[model samples]
Target: MKAKLGISPIAWWNDDLPELSDDVSLEECLRQSRSAGFTGIEKGRRFPDDPTVMSSILKMVNVALCGGWFSGTLVNEDIATNKHRIQPMIDLFKAVNAPCIVYGEVGHSIQSDRSRPLATKPVLSDADMKAYARRMTEFGEWCAGQGMPLSYHHHMAAVVQFEHELDTFMKCSGEGIPLLFDAGHLAFAGGDVLRVIDNHHKRINHVHVKDIRGPVIKALDWRTQSFLDAVALGAFTVPGDGSLDFGAIVQKLAGYGYEGWFVVEAEQDPRKNPPLRMAEMGYAELMRVTTKAGYVVEAPTFPWR
Candidate 1:
């Protein structure tokens, strides 16, 4: 299997929590990513909206645009509103040839709300999920038709946060919407990482190989603390430095014939764990694990499109 190694810029500069970010420019972030041996870097708040400008910035650092998050609200919004909102991101991704847009469900989500407790996250009933899933499928179909397929990101504190919730979402939704498998968030949600991959391997188009800091996660009071609170307490980290066994995880994915980008998306405080150092660690661990899984890692290509 062939795969590309990538990292998200959240480690360098977090959009949700500016206090946890490193005071760095976009060029410097890309430069550090390339220096850490990451051929691709996902979008962040510092990235310009114009594709040409974004391409030039990436080219200077010898990296490519892998994928980026797109906050989606299919739960509360209609298909028409979603299409209108996502068209610009679709155009941008198509221009740069990104693998896929990470579609994070943010409607009624308390992921960014520091005051709200984790246990207070919104939930969908069986009937609510059935209808929401259909809306998401249609939206996914439209995004695919636009030449920028979306990978649904089941995030923490979102409506579809838990393992059972993901199962129901997958069962109700069609293949029109693909899955963005994130190991850390799944682990934080009390999910069996390997079991989740086994259940939804067929629909997984993108992967986020984030690792969890088990002790910090265990310390969090779910009823009093928020998702962001767990993050503030250092609940996430790069592979090989945390709880998950990426070697076995990669092997499971390889056995299932999955081939695509495996991005390191551990959003941590830059002050405690330097972004470049964390990026290097993530790259090395992924190289070791992916190679063991018999994957031929590809080099970054120029002219993103």
Candidate 2:
């Protein structure tokens, strides 16, 4: 099977290192991604938010905008508030021709209405679940009408972190909305990545090919801080170096007939690992895993000029 691979530009943005800025420029990032063998890239917040600018960049590099995460409160808020947060993002994404907006747990707590850890008391009651489902359905329908899909993200520190929470969210959301599966995040949250895909392969629309160091992941608990916090602390990394079984994941995705982009998403501290080297290493690892799993990995075209 022929598969298109990509990388998240966020992999190049590490807050801990100031000297690495030169390496993360748009031109350089695209150059490294292509040289390292990625066919596309997911736009990060550091990229220009304006649709025209973003479109121009993607066109220049011959890389597709795979999609990005929208960190807004969708599950535990009123419909109006949720719409307010998501509508503009959807419009912006539409303008760029991106396929989906990765949906994850909101920052605030749904139960206490106060700022609390995402793994705090789950606020999803039966009524809340139904309402969430209705809201997600509405959002999915809206996105479909606009020619985009809402790919829900199962984050480690979010409300849908654990297996049960993921199960509840998927059950409540029904069949309309698709999911953006992040292998590392699921593993960090104590989920069986292969099993989740096996059960809900149909709902998976995109894949974030990230991996995590088991020791680093086990050192932190969701009850203490958010997943984004862990990301800032360099909790995740590229495949092969971490504990995830990418060979199994690739085989399972292939079995499920998934043909979407496999985006390399390592949100780590670049101070520890330079972004360019990381991208090169990550691409090599991804290629090895894909090839071992009986898939043809395409060589990416370098566009440094």
| Residue lDDT tens for model 1, 18-120 | 8999999888898899899889988988898898898788778778889999888889988888788889888988888788899999999999999999999
Best by TM-score: 1
- Native-vs-model 1 lDDT? 0.92
Encode model 2's per-residue lDDT on 1-305: one tens digit a residue.
76778898777764333333445578778878877777778776577877777777776867767777776576656656766777777777778667678876564433223244436745566777677766877777776776777888876545566777777778877667888888887888788889999888988988999989888767766566655556655678898778888888988999878876788988777777777788888888888878777778663333232
Candidate lDDT (C-alpha), each: 0.92, 0.73
TM of each candidate vs. truth: 0.98, 0.85
Candidate 1 worst ten-residue window by lDDT = 296-305
- Backbone clash total for model 2 is 0
